[model samples]
Target: MPLSERKVVARRVTLELANLVIKYGRPIVVNLGVGIPAMVGEVVAEEEVEDLITITVESGTWGGRPLYGPDFGVSLGAFAVISVPDQFTMYEGGVIDAASLGFLQIDAQGNVNSFYAKDRIPGPGGFPAIASGAPEIYYAGLFTAGKGAKYEIGNGRLKIVSDGEIVKFVKKVDKVGCSSKVMLEQGKRVLYITERAVFRLTPEGPELLEVAPGVDLEKDVLAKMEFSPIMRREPEQMDERIFGHRRMNIKKELLKAIRA
Candidate 1:
């Protein structure tokens, strides 16, 4: 397949994520969210992450590599698989350690709105349960949409860090997919990972932990985010080691297997 600029960039984002999850050392059940992160599981699985982390598909299968082609396949290097029927059950109830999911919008309350795209809203399928109930959640998406990169963080609820800026990170969520108030109380970790920067929702609100390597704070990442997070020391590049050899880049593998 010929590579386009968009595809190349998207793959970079996926690779970065492959690095992020591995840092945690394959948790018991890494909920492979749709899109890039699913491929990340395959990448990790081909390597040793599978031995450490049991990769579960939204499907029920527990220990088989991905079979890609038939289900609108994408290739990945993973070990073990399951049917989607079983996967959603675990998803709806709660048996996930970390979820690398995407979102269309995120507000100060830490709520997410990924289902509401223009033509249709898929309604929140398994989102509320996963976002709210998951022990660890990582919200992943692109940094800037065509929205021109600016907005206002209204002064309704939480006493926050900043207001009026670009979007996705906010002073309060417009609707509650996940609540910062609840997260802090429960002590579960919620991360905001984007192509532009990485932030964490803490008791203090969104804190800027790291920017992708070679990206600058004021010049690149910070200015793009709607609000300024409390930047800790310069953020480091998520380690590539996370996507060890065998399992790394499993997308193609799964897709190929399913096709075969």
Candidate 2:
């Protein structure tokens, strides 16, 4: 069966993150948050780099594929399953090398609202602890929200059939789930990854880093955002392979990059 467009976008974001892990060229522990961030475990597992990239979930599981939905708090083949408090202890103590978290909204200042909205109240769930502790954080999710968004993917490209009505990047988030100020003071590396664009949180503010292929810079990206991002240079195109259906063979790429 073919993967849905949403799932494909999730995989693409996950693979991009996997590439970042590979670039470290050494063993590291990484925490996966809920939603699209949970897909990282599946991507790492498929890449066969579990030994190098240790997967951790807030539910106290480590070194396995992180489950989603009803099974969100467990891993399929975890090497360890400690108490939830112990897992949080590691996070609050800065034991993890990195973390990937989902966001409900992101502001011009890079503040993230992962939980809470005008209509919902999921509350902040391990986001505060993990975001505060991890030296590096990647915020992952779709480019837009709300109902009726549509897209097409083929031939290594993405075509926006109809965009979501809700704009995720805003002037100010409804609530600040993760503070950009604190992260900057702590000197953490931060990135926002969406289906069509990537932004890096810098001293100057959010900088536009990369854009997916076939997406219009003006109509599809810049025009949709609430505020302008720093364009230090022409943004690079996101890797073309992510748009296709075939396996990325990320293990081979990781090994090659490590060897070089």
Candidate 3:
């Protein structure tokens, strides 16, 4: 059976986030949040760059492939499994080099709403500590919401069969689970990654950075957002390899990038 569109998008997002490790050019530790962010650890394992990139989970497991869904809090080959409090201590101490988290809503001011909406209240979990402590953060999630949103993937491109009825990027989020003001005060680097586009949090607002292939800038992106994002210049196209079915050979790319 072919992979679902959601799974494909998750892989695309994972590849892009994994590639970010190369930019650091040295060994680093990263906390992978639940949902789409958990997929990054699997990609790191597949690419065999475990030695260069350490994966940590909120459940206190470190240096292993993070599992998702029912196995969400555990790892496959974790080198260490400390107490949950200890894990949080590491996060709060700014020991984590980077973090990738999922978001429910993000506003023009770059505030993230992760775990509360109307009657839904999953609480913030470990998001606050990780978001405020990590020097760099990559917020990953789908571009839109609602069951109406549909997509097709082929030929190294994305096709929006039908856009989601609900827009995630809003003029103001329902709640602020991660505050841009706090992140800025700590000098944290923040980027929001989705299936169709990437944005960087700036003093002005979220700045458009990259758009996926086959996506319409006006129809798919700008039209779907609740507010206009800062576009300093023409946004570059996302890495084409992200849409392809073949392996991206991320390990080779990371090593090459480090050598450069």
Candidate 4:
């Protein structure tokens, strides 16, 4: 299938987030959420850090490279597959360090609506258990979704192909898949990652943390969202490595780290 501009940009976001998770978080057990978040494990596998971080999915597979799309449950190089009950036990016991998942809607309260909308009712799947159990949760998706949604990456920059009609960040969600207030009260950290920007959940709401290169903060990002994010005085620009056609050398570094 031909990749969409949004998917291209989202892949870059996933690569960037995966690198951060490897460096700063260094999670020993991580669950790469479905959809855009699933790419995190693919990038990790490319980086060759499978041994360092146990890549797992909600379907009970562990230490394997996750497959995307319709073949999601299948994996390569998996260490083992446990029963569903055992997997949830691990998740509920706070064994997962981080979970990178997809989102359909996020509200000012940081509540997520990944499942169950007016047109769609796929249900939360394992989102509730994963969201509640993980110490840090990252929601990954495009800033907006609908007709005309598109983008491009070139010359170490990002350009919009066509803006999507729907805004994802809102004042309220149609249904709460994971309650932001409840998660925060448990002292868990939450972050929302988009192709254009990254937002961290604060007491007030989602706070802008970083903006992508060649992106206008006001016109490209803030103006596109339904709700206003708590902006940093000078938000950090997204890593240049995430843009352009260059291949990242994270695998080399991962091998080196392992050897040491």
Clashes found in each candidate (C-alpha, N, C closer than 3 A): 41, 0, 0, 0
- Go through the candidates in order and give each one's C-alpha lDDT: 0.52, 0.83, 0.83, 0.77
Q: Alpha-carbon error at 218 in model 2, in Å?
A: 0.5
lDDT per residue as tens, model 4, 57-110: 988899888888888877787889998889989999998877788899999888
Q: Which runs in model 3 stand beyond 4 Å of their true positions?
A: 1-21, 257-260
Compared with the true structure, what per-residue lDDT tens digits does model 3 show for residues 1-260?
13445445456555644556666777778898998788777666666888878889999998978887678998988999999999998899999888889999999999999998787756999999888778889898889988888887777788888977778999999989999998888898899988889899999989999998999999999999989999999999887766766666777777787778
Candidate 4, residue 179: Cα displacement in angstroms equals 1.2
**Local accuracy of candidate 2 as per-residue lDDT tens digits, 86-160:** 999999999988888999898899899999888775699889999999988989888899898989887778888
The deviation in Å at residue 232 for candidate 1 is 4.6
TM per candidate comes to: 0.64, 0.93, 0.92, 0.89
Error of 1 at 167 (Å): 4.8
Runs in model 4 lying further than 4 Å from the true structure: 1-27, 251-260
Give the 10-residue window scoring lowest on summed lDDT in candidate 4. Answer: 1-10
Clashes of 1: 41
